[model samples]
Target: MSGRFAELHLDQVQRAFGDTVALKGMDLTIKGGEFVALLGPSGCGKSTALNCLAGLLPLTGGRITLDGKRIDDLPPEKRGFGMVFQNYALFPHMSVRRNIGFGLSMRRTGKAELNRRVDEAVRLVQLEEHQHKFPAQLSGGQQQRVAIARAIVLEPPLVLMDEPLSNLDAALRLEMRTEIRRLHQSLGLTTVYVTHDQEEALALADRLVVLRLGEVQQVGSPEEVYAHPVNRYVAGFMGYRNMIPVTVGSQEGEHATVHTEAGVKLVGVKREELGSEAVAAVRPEDFAVVTEIGANTIEAVVEIVEYHGREQAVEARLRDGTQLHVRTNSRLAPGDTITLKVPAERVLVFA
Candidate 1:
């Protein structure tokens, strides 16, 4: 290992393409042994930021430092950082063992040392049985394992993964997510992962840096970010499928009563500085079917219902013709009228 990675800092890091900027000034400090995810949708600069950190793309301004020393100017190979690309990127003809040891071989590592490290890497990824198989011979999951093994075999203190699980199927993605977490803990690697999937970021990251249009939207622990998004855009990204326009009627401490554009009164926790107009963001799963008319309740007609095993995913239209997504266990079909109530704490109002 390259000694223990103490800390990494991106100070005012920016990337520009001629007149168009792909990443804005981003400042972040990542502690050793921490898993930080760069999360956002397509064209959100998550990948641009990761590439900048990896020395794949030169920064337009600012600098990156590791343990208080500048490393952003170093070439990727000289930085001694391991990288796992989105695609497996394994050599088609090379055997798994050879692929895992390619970096060591390129550095002219001693034969015995190379064998030992490759063997350990193979075991770490639990691919001992297929060590002799070429990339074409392995399954997608197995190929991904080989890719991971290849990177870790170098014993780089910091690992950068660019949507490493994006190519896998749903089941395989979940499986590899667990595997990646295990490897991070067992090896004590400082990981910077880039992904557009919010759930994956929440599941794997100790901290999340949400980006939008090249600018950082928020940075917080998964629990904090998921429970309390800072803005309407972030709320939408974090699975709040319903965004209702409202006019604030009254404010009481941290709660606000607002009249919806459709003239329905609803209460929600105030999350930001509000003007007369604000948005009420609610996660579909937060809506509950209520039997009585109460605070924060909405009367809507079910437009669509889809089975999601434990709950039914519903698309409903409010009296004012606003569509809302709700997740409920109630047995309901299209055209059925239902009253969905969201707890005040569950509804977030943002200006």
Candidate 2:
């Protein structure tokens, strides 16, 4: 699918169900061979956007173009895109081989071509040993592999995956994540994936489109979006567990010094236009237990501690009842006092 599906553009895309809108004016351009993930919480319209792109859902407004040709008006089969659903929507009675070749059979492809594609897809997914087994005989991961093989065997220019790994266990999900990335790279397929899992999105996508309440919040490369989120909502999704309300004491070019309600002063990199009121966003991993702290320090009492193998996840509370989560190597118990320090560069300030 190299140059066949070069570019896809979603221009002012909108989807609504009567009075309720699921997606609104979502604009995105995906180049060939790029992996883009639509990320947001439930009811955020990521799935709605994917359905719109796949022609499973009709557009209430705007248009979708593939290689400069409009396709929003086309039906699902007419658009010729492959979709792997979350439930691994395979026929229970069909064997792995039949499941993978279902699309070709429906298209009335030649027997010789169909067999060749099915065999290649089985090998591609490493499911050759189980080709004769039914879906009930296969594991969830294997069933998912069959679903993926079925989609790719058609050699669709674009692939749409709606949380394909959500049904698997953690270990299986991790393994399948690598497999999907390998398939995308080897086949050079343009992929649009939808997931609410930030870690999965960060691991699989070349770029991320973060949505909230049917609207796009931010779009950028994984590193850019992970390191620098545009707002508190995006920051929270990107692992910023602490959003401390503060009053800006001073503002420099791109940095600000703000005082928390507990009288803790923090210096953070500012990315938005701010007034006196602002929020300091910090990830749990960015906070460190320090003995000496002259700046960017918060003193709190530990409330709960969770052992996470490599490090301890501690929940602490400030004098004003604000809760802060900290990830540190030091062992601590409830009611213990600790000083947490955050580097200015690791902090993000938003209005």
In Å, residue 76's CA in model 1 sits off its true spot by 0.6
Off by over 4 Å in 2: 1-3
**Pairing residues by index, what is the TM-score of model 1?**
0.98
Every candidate's lDDT: 0.92, 0.93
What tens-digit string does per-residue lDDT give for candidate 1 at 178-264?
999999888888899999999999999999999999999999999999998999999999999999988999999999999987788
- Residue 18's C-alpha lDDT in candidate 2? 99
Residue 5 of model 2 has an lDDT of: 73
RMSD of every prediction: 1.1, 1.3
Q: In model 2, where is the ten-residue run with the lowest total lDDT?
A: 1-10
